[model samples]
Target: MNNTSTTTLTMKREFNVKPEKVFDAWLNPVTMKKWFFTLEGTNKVAQNDPKVGGSWEIVDHRQGVDYRAIGDYVEINSPEKIVFTFKMPQFSELEDTITVELKELGQGSEMTFTQLIHAENEEQWTDADIVKALDEMRDGTEHGWNLMFMGLKELVETGKVSYQG
Candidate 1:
């Protein structure tokens, strides 16, 4: 999600790998954690269930506060597209959609991540406390995504995943 209010962030990353493998990484828990984060440099995959009513859990042992994103699959097309509703009510945004699309490119694939983020702060203009909370959440969430994606790229390319997700 974009921090610039109402708008969402659209990041496209091209990988020199097969579409099936790339797509599998997204659906397979082990694969997902390897390239799940949009930015990179993050780890800990408790449960990355890809089916409907599945979860994208993480390890809280690395930090003082535990965080998790639970979601249900809205749509799934193997090696092509995936749509899911992600929610972390207490820690971050709720009712967000994470969609990933894979397209073959020459001898590689292009993985596009599109997120629709709702600025919870946009609706709480009158509440200073809520705005403050939302601000911090947005910053933290984006950083997390960044680190996750970076880590994912490294893991996938190296074929050395620390966890199966």
Candidate 2:
């Protein structure tokens, strides 16, 4: 039996930076380390090849726990859009597709980020339990992404990266 379920999370943010800069930051290892993964004692290894069929991996090590995110580039349109597959090795049951679209504003940019999360082997979850779990996951994911985006904005605006928590 194959049981799969999906949920999508979407977010939009405006940045006082050019679309190119914002797009490049997502693929740059140095910039990604500063904003994307800011956990203390977490060592990040980011390797990104932004092209169709190319792959990217980011490994964060904290307290002897390694959280690995591996993905492949499905589509890339410079300064405008990117689509990729995302997976966390530690949670093999969860897989997702992420897309980022950038629109040029007056002198800045607006980014729309979307993630479609797919879970396998979810047949065991009751309908009510699944709904609750997804709600909690969405809340937690939003909070985390908001913090990361804050760091990204700081880095792009002030050339400094600081995470409040």
Candidate 3:
């Protein structure tokens, strides 16, 4: 059985860089290693194929375990928009879709990120339990994305990343 409910999380940020620069940072492996789904002191395996239908994987090798994130690109529009599906096989089977939209704002750019988090087995969980789980997931996901954005901002503005997990 499949539960089709989804919760959408939206976040927005402004960067002191052009849309093209900010957009490219997302797909570039070198830049991605500095921020995207990474933590301090972790060896990164970041690979990207920035095209519609292309797939990406980033594995962070920690002390005793490796955290792997895999995704496939659903849409891509240079300096404007990107849509992709995100999943962590080590965590759960639920896959989420994320959309990143960028627009020029004066001398810089603004990015709007939206994520559709799919609900888990509704049949096995109570409404309160589901709500709590979703709330936690939203909070954690937002924090992770915010950290990534901080790194991205630093990278685009200073050509370096200083944000540590």
Best by TM-score: 3
Model 1, global lDDT: 0.64
lDDT of 3 by residue, 31-111 (tens): 777777874357468898899999998888876789999999999999899999999998877899999999999999999
Worst 10 residues of 3 by lDDT: 35-44
Structural similarity to truth (TM-score) of each candidate: 0.71, 0.89, 0.91
Q: Candidate 1 vs candidate 3: which has greater TM-score?
A: 3
Candidate 2 ranges with C-alpha deviation above 4 Å? 38-41, 120-124
Better model by lDDT, 1 or 3? 3
**Arranged by lDDT, best first:** 3, 2, 1
After the best TM-score superposition of candidate 1, give how far the Cα of residue 164 lies from its true spot, in angstroms.
Answer: 15
Model 2 scores a C-alpha lDDT of 0.81
Please rank every candidate by TM-score, starting with the best.
3, 2, 1
Which stretches of model 1 miss by more than 4 angstroms? 1-5, 33-45, 52-56, 122-142, 161-165
lDDT of 1 by residue, 1-165 (tens): 223344355678877777787777667766554455321235445466666666565433233554555677877888899888777667565477888888999988888887776665544355665556656656666776766666555565677545433
Evaluate model 2: give its TM-score.
0.89
